[model samples]
Target chain A: MALIKDQQLSCSHAATPEMRFTDWVSGGSDAGDAVLANGADDLPSLLAQAGKLSMIAIEFDTFADGRGFSMARMLRRQGYAGEIRAVGDVAMDRIDFMQRVGFNAFELRDDQDALQALQKIGEVSVHFQPSADGKGPAYMV
Target chain B: MYAYNEFDQTLIDQRVEQYRDQTRRYLAGEIPEEEFRVLRLMNGLYIQRLAPMLRVAIPYGLMKSDQLRMLAQISRTYDKGYGHFTTRQNMQFNWPTLESVPDILADLAKVQMHAIQTSGACIRNTTTDPFAGVSADEIEDTRPWCELIRQWSTLHPEFAYLPRKFKIAVSGSSSDRAASQVHDIGLHLYRNEVGDMGFEVLVGGGLGRTPVIGKTLRKFLEPQELLTYLDAVLRVYNLNGRRDNKYKARIKILVNALGVDAFGAMVEAEWQLIKGQELRLPEAEIERVKGFFKAPDYLSAMHASRDLNDTFAEHPQFAAWYKQNTRDHKQAGYRIIIVALKNQLQAPGDVNHQQMDGIAALADEFSFSELRSTHDQNLVLADVAQRDLFALWLKLQDLGLARANVGTLTDMINCPGLDFCSLANAETLILSRQVNETFDDMDYLYDLGEIQLKISGCINACGHHHVGHIGILGVEKGGKQVYQFTLGGSASNDASLGKTLGRSIEQDQVVVVIGQILDVYVEQRQTDETFLQVIRRVGFAPFKERVYGTHQRSAA
Candidate 1:
């Protein structure tokens, strides 16, 4: 699997064990990163501990399941500065969109090339919606 | 029409390149067909029954003459020598090759157009009144707001892959000419009691497998915060809408599942958080978009409209065309000409390349080089001079574009159906022709008056069968195509769904049933009462009895 960070190929440093939302609510033994599923309804509880977490790897069960996109946006809007990684079914075609909606790192699916995905993420230099850092919407820019 | 700025042009250019790369990859087997399906649909390329159908956005149904010419050129070069106008006010080339779609999009980009988000699970082209700026009864022109929403929805990062396709429509006037009540999100422009112009927002209304009229989310949404409010609504749908069931994934289903009150609260909570953020429209941007839609300079070109009497005196046919195919414009001397594209020579809304060029030339000579397409599947010269009506009518007649059938029963909105669409259960274009030929008498159609006969090949409702005054749905029972008839629905200020009359009828006999219903209306109508008025007054017993008389005659 290719890991993309800062618009380039990067080694996977996120080897820490992550806490699933279900496990955390059920009182898991260990806590590291937060693994938030797209369908998880306990985002408010996760937000309460968002500051302490180093990463929130949002799960995408399928490439077409777009709940992760909105989840990333809400996480960023709530001022979570930690890395938001997209895992599972992530591909090069949607890399640019993931970045625009506040995904800082992408754990690409097995088939996609890290180098090609990087080029695609930087392709369409303008976006219509504002990024998490409020960079665009193309009109004001 | 909102002119494309340099930024807008760049985005479209880049998009063409992006879609080109995606198409190339898919063709090269680098991208699988399953994944490519989503990508191509996002670009409006649908793998149809015959060939790949390409749907190009006509932003809020407005197009410049050059753009119309470019569409004509594309249809000639890549597709068949014709293009079809859709109920959503877009253009469709029914026979485009998948390999050559990128080239077509590139050509569209040259004319400041694209097929971005016309299909797929994303926010689509936001439509409004074709007579937006020129309509006399509108509170104001809604094209600017449509443009604003278009920009906001274009390549929207989060919404690119929603659970289902999302559609939004704006109504400039309270009369709902844009069919706002049957959209995913309907924005009604109105002045509140305080005299501040805002919007009454409706969510979850759609015409599909389960047709539901939209429910109100907010009584009034402040103008500047339109984008923010929309973001909230889309976010709520994206977050909570069903992903498991494809049929129930539309926002309408989610609205019903959560109930409108709970759904509205969720959207309201999200809006409270993002209310005045970057999405807040600056007064300058709103005014800047408005400036692009301002009235053309030929405001008082009272050139020879007074000679209209002379034209009337000369040709009775021209007088009939003038009375039926044109409407009063906000500008006194100007008129909005509904170039009758719904005639016998072609299918409903189909325009050959020559007809497109003819309409473009007519617009250039008479209507300030601007044109508009309506949801009714007709073209409009929104600012034609009254004096030019006769000349325009003559030119349109020569091109076979004048039918004097606008708003009449023969001017039907028919989907491509099983002829092209893969999702269709039956064919509709030929059925539409059969009905047209059966009701070819113009005087009878005119006497019937303002009847919307919409047909759908399936329950997907692309033809908006739910809202037609006379809705016809084609379903296959026992491998035989049969049709169900509905009565008394409308897509106007008075919005309602048509009710089923009796049972399904066979294809050959569908025309007989329709004729009997129309005959019933004519037989039972009071003076000047429309089909809807007669149905509302007398209920469906008369229609049911006549439509089922043959079936029940032998059975009962």
Candidate 2:
């Protein structure tokens, strides 16, 4: 069980590297690397060293603080090909919003069940507009 | 008075089906709760702390008597026999179940009304001068243009998902009754020196957390190119508006960051590409909308009759009401009567099922069977006969809708605050009651004269406190309600933002504080100086000194 801290993580977390899920995918490390890759200085260098990183972690200090959501979108639009994992204060209420902006996995807070959060994320049946993941079929033109 | 065409009808009908489908899917457990929350809000359905509230749009505050009766029937059938008219000139029913909403939409559709774009980050209703067609001073009737914009923006594909909710208001009158300066887009219609009618377009004005006066983007946009230019402005905002922070997402912030000149240039550049394109209003279409709003055949009787003067002398109350609520009409022997919804006891804009029916009946009797909902929450019977004034007054008095406080202090503009609104931080209705009770003396209110008191429950400024002559903002401090007051705001031709008078006071102290402020005004004011003029001349210093002085003395 991943212990998702709700406080905003330091800038060093964005620079950390992780094990590659697929060689074809080239981006920063997954969000899980924040805990796995310890210390501040090594994170950015590790992110630079990865030839095909597939995921990255970002923290939301509070449920209302939406800075992390923007950070994830900026990373995706800047051509970072990776899974953006949302950690910290990521609840079921915010899952659809996070997914719309391009977050793939949400590490739930300690008190909340991850399985329930995942189920909640899968339950969205309709979307009005295209998201960071891709444009909707209706908007493909 | 602009009638919906087939295209407009079809669009609303389609939107109803869309909402119905979404509701069905939610109930069937296909869409998750959180996702459905956003979807339902977009459809103007809010699950309040108590029950489901449905907000129905009263576009540009114009409604036929039939429409008003339909609302009354809907309230009786679907809701709790009452509907609350909102600050935005819309109406909200507090107790509609989720299951009954589709039925409500169906009912509203029967009367050519729907709640589409009433909520969500879309182009909301295009509000305008309530006295649009009937105002003696109007440059042109703006209802046709408002109706055109309504059709154009309803479920518009490209601009649906903007950074924030957008509002546009237009004024045909030089007095600025529509509060055009405080809207997302404020358009003042005028005929230039060459006798060609155009709009003086103002953009980026809003009243929420960061209240701003809209800047003039176009000094003169030709009537035909209005929609295209508006589209260009919206496109610029849609693509570049900050979506990350909801607080900084309004077009005002974007316009401010870019500077007005650069923003106007960008809009002009975009307009150059699309000006002669598909969005331009066709001559036939413009005429078709205008045909519905042509002035009715009014009798050419000049001056008041002996009967009217006799009635005035016989009835002082009726005379006072006439003096305050009635306005000069363009046609001789005709007047525009405002039915004041700002009565003392009831919520500012709440018209009961019976009152709604009565108003509908009254509209049928006078005013060419048309009624308008002003932004200040009053209903206007815009073509009253001079001979029928006394009779109309008597009937209106019977229904408790004949308050003479048209633009007076007691004619307060307030939101449904904590009593019905979930977003409210404090109870605005109670504060309104307190203020009303404290200033119940009609003579005192008349003495003060034409002061606009606007209160908002929260920082969203739905009650338009930023533009009030005396603005009271309800803030929550440590789980308790506190009232903050601002002075010198005006939403008329000379629009200005209110300045904070002093520190926040407790809820109970609001009425007394307001009284003290009024006391200061009375003491310092010169003869015939209005509340706004006095505030402008003497400044907030005297009022602040009095209010704070009383506070310190009480503390000691």
Give the number of the best model, judged by lDDT. Answer: 1
lDDT of 2 by residue, B193-222 (tens): 999999999999988999999999989998
RMSD of 2: 8.9
Candidate 2: residue B529 lDDT (0-100): 92
Candidate with top TM-score is 1
Q: CAPRI verdict on model 2?
A: incorrect
Q: List the residue pairs that clash in candidate 2.
A: A15-A43, A29-A55, A30-A55, A30-A56, A31-A56, A31-A57
lDDT of 2 by residue, A1-141 (tens): 332222222223343224332321234334433322211123334344333444566555555344455444445544666656776666655665577666666666665555445544424333333356564322122
- Candidate lDDT values, in order: 0.87, 0.78
On the 0 to 100 scale, the lDDT of residue B268 in model 2 is 83
Which candidate's DockQ is highest?
Answer: 1
Q: For model 1, how does the per-residue alpha-carbon lDDT over B63-88 read when each residue is reduced to its tens digit?
A: 99999999999988998899999999
